[model samples]
Target: MIEILDPAQLPRARAVGALVATILQTAKARCQVGTNLLDIDAWTRSMIEDAGAESCYVDYAPSFGRGPFGHYICTSVNDAVLHGLPHDYAVVDGDLVTLDLAVSLDGVVADSAVSFVVGQGRPEDTAMITATREALAAGIAAARPGARVGDLSHAIGTVLRAAGYPVNTEFGGHGVGSTMHQDPHVPNDGRPGRGFKLRPGLLLALEPWVMADTATLVTDADGWTLRSATGARTAHSEHTVAITRDGAEVLTLPPAA
Candidate 1:
């Protein structure tokens, strides 16, 4: 389902977006060497509860994933990329971790993700994370009224390809509003001007992720975490954006310190 927010709903959307962003930032800061993945999930839950916001993930049963995610946040470590279910695991130095989160505030929803090294950053891992971040930025810049969804996809794909990372089409960005995922699937790679046309009040979560070696993915025994087929490292970055008259407004930006 595609949802367009009315002017009155924008404020709620902004609030949810801010909350999601702040939670991700705080979780990232707390993730260090030896930190348990479950701890991260707990932190996310506390933050959401304290804000009186609802988690869009917990109890989320989608066809693509196993029923009831049963977690407050997605803690994707090392080779893991999407739908990473938090388990009994401790982060180590140089481990690339991706945290994806979505929450509802005042009946509006926003989703975002971020990837970074746990402790001492690896040069290659850092580069991969930077590429995804840049790709996300490009995608957001293309999200303007009258622009095609393909334009955003193309912009995101261009950055990943230029960075020498293969693009995966299976999972990508999507419409987000009252629900976490909605219609108008936004692929990471597509021809410009060839898909759904953007309109004012349209909210989209654009994410760009890539494996260091292969584009293929393998599911973990847990049935949720998706890891790279070759065990190569990976990175992911995402942001929630709202189309407007002049351009796109990034609702899930990190709060000013």
Candidate 2:
């Protein structure tokens, strides 16, 4: 369902956005070489509980995924990209990790994701992460009151293609408001003038992700983690944005250090 949040609801939306951002940032900070993936999930749970926010992931049963995600956060490592279920694994130096999170506070929801190297960074991995981040920025910049969803998708696709990465259309951004995922599916690539028109109070989670080599994906035995078909490394970046008269307001920016 598409939800145009009321002005009064925007504040609650912002609060939930802030909470999700802070939790992701905190998880990123705690991630290091030898850190267990389960630990990261635990940390996320504690933070959300402390803030009195509900996890939009845990217990989440969507048709695309196995029922009940049963985790507080998504910890994608190396070849893993989306729906990465936390498991018994420890991060190592040079590992590229993506953390995706969504939470509800005061009855509003926000979602965001970030990809970064765990310890000593690999140049190629760093470049991939940068590309996704740039693409996400481009997508958000295209999210204006009069712009179409395709404009945002085109902007994102342009950045990724310019960076020499193949775009995947299966999973992309989507409308977000009272629910984690809603109508107006925002693909990573599309015609600029086509698709749903943007309006004030529309909230969208724009994500851009790419694999180092192939665009194809393979599901892990766990039935949740999605990895590159060729075991190529991947990176993902995302943000929850609100369309307004002025432009897009990014609600999931990490808190200032």
> What global local distance difference test value does model 1 have?
0.92
What TM-score should be assigned to candidate 2?
0.99
TM-score of each: 0.98, 0.99
lDDT of each: 0.92, 0.92
- Find the number of clashing residue pairs for candidate 1: 0
| Residue pairs whose backbone atoms clash in candidate 2 | none
**Cα lDDT, model 1, residue 38:** 97
Could you tell me which residue pairs clash in candidate 1? none
lDDT score, candidate 2, position 180: 91
**Candidate 2, superposed: residue stretches over 4 Å from native:** none
